[model samples]
Target: MIEPETVIICLRAAMLGAGAVCFGAGSAALLLAPPQVASVLRAYLQPVLRGAAGVLAVAALVSLAVQTADASEDWSQAISPSALFMFATTTHAGRTSSARALLAVVSALCILLARGNRIALLRLGSLTAGLFLASFAFSGHAAMHDEPTRTLQEANHIAHVLSGTFWTGALVALFCAAIILLRRPSGDQVEGAELMLRRFSPAGVTAVVIVGLTGALNTWLILGRAPLDRGSIYQLLLAAKIAAVAVMLGLALANRFYFLPRATRPAALVASIAIECALGALVIALVAVFGTLEPV
Candidate 1:
């Protein structure tokens, strides 16, 4: 028989993955385009986000199946394997919707930014993201109570999640944009692309800083400021997530300092984009770990 703890762990992982993917994709898609074009791009998100959503959807359904079976029967053997799949599927769907909502609004603001009004887009996106993320924490089991500590932790956690998503999404969008410019080689678009790239760099830097601040805040609230002689699992997980993020930042810095400015070779650019995507996937997976880990 499958262990209850195993099931719980997997369900949490699925939740984290769905949340991160949805939010990240939303931010990146919106950031990649100008206000108007971003609106249109919303309709054409890449299959990775969709596919992940689908998989998580199935997983949620599967979880529901197991829970239902257990509830009706022994509360142990209630949900069959198939039912568990359904649980994961449905849960993933909700998570994906939350993310897509955030992304959609960002895309809407894309049009405004495209018209050379980025401050407007940032303000709009940030405001929208806050509302959506609040909806996010309460949407699940975490909303069961309204205790003060939990309320604060929940808010901080939500901020951490949103900031991470924004950071990763922007990176993905920029990476994709880089690939497009390298392959297409259009003189008319070159200047525009270059300007966008420059704009993206500072944005990336900002995201990294925000990520650090939010993450530190989350840690302080979640784990008290007691020094540990050795690393616990949460610490280990946080370290892994942070390392992954640092590597990604390094790559971005390399691109900005070395490749992007020089208009590096197409081969080099493609390589960097692929690396960015791979690292992003790693970051997403690591984020899943962060969610599951205990604060203490």
Candidate 2:
């Protein structure tokens, strides 16, 4: 049976993970997508980002309350002004959660009401998204280690998250493009879609490579030379997450090397991308659970 605290953590992780994905999609549109494709993608991404940021802000506040309650060992103290203040100012976890909440609100406002040129808005969104991703490291397993190991673990985790989010988010963006522009598209739309794929390839490939390399480094840093105990729940969940990622990678490769070059079957391309997004969602769900578990 899952504990209440575990459930809260899982919920928070899911919300934050989802928000990160949305942010990644916006960033990918701004950075990797062509202007023609990006303009269309933003129409789909803006409201999603706004909703995600709002969710993330709420999750951060709830997480902060939960952490305070745990630290005080009194449920009522979750809202006690003195207790909350002490926790927020004195504890690392509390400080991080507060920062996360603040950033989430800022990101949401930026997305919803900030008036700027297209480039300015995109730049603002990217900055907020990167900062949001960085906050996750402080509250994660990486913070448990000592000295240089902690710093290295944090860096590795951040890289892993950035790359994974970028890769998965780009897949989502690609799916949207396929749906909007590729179904009985005009000649120019078809050409734009193809150009989007070509532009995405380099960044997508790099993100995949970073995710794999950093994930390996993170596992090693966390567990050291100890063999993974198959009997442990943590190990089992970890294994499952890895397997999901591996399958995602395979799908990505197929899309890049096979379907992408052919470009004739819009339906096939859309189907493949949808499948990858589904797998990515699975991986995020697994992460929400295993990430809260202790490694043996």
Best by TM-score: 2
- Kindly list the per-residue Cα lDDT of model 2 for residues 43-64, writing each as its tens digit: 7666666666667667767777
TM-score, one value per model: 0.66, 0.90
Quantify all predictions' global Cα lDDT against the true fold.
0.55, 0.74
lDDT score of model 1?
Answer: 0.55
Q: Count the backbone clashes (under 3 Å) in each candidate.
A: 35, 0
Extract clashing residue pairs from model 2.
none
Worst 10 residues of 1 by lDDT: 108-117
Q: For model 1, state the Cα shift of residue 62 in Å.
A: 4.1
Which RMSD does model 1 reach against the true structure? 7.3
lDDT of 2 at 154: 87
Best candidate, lDDT: 2
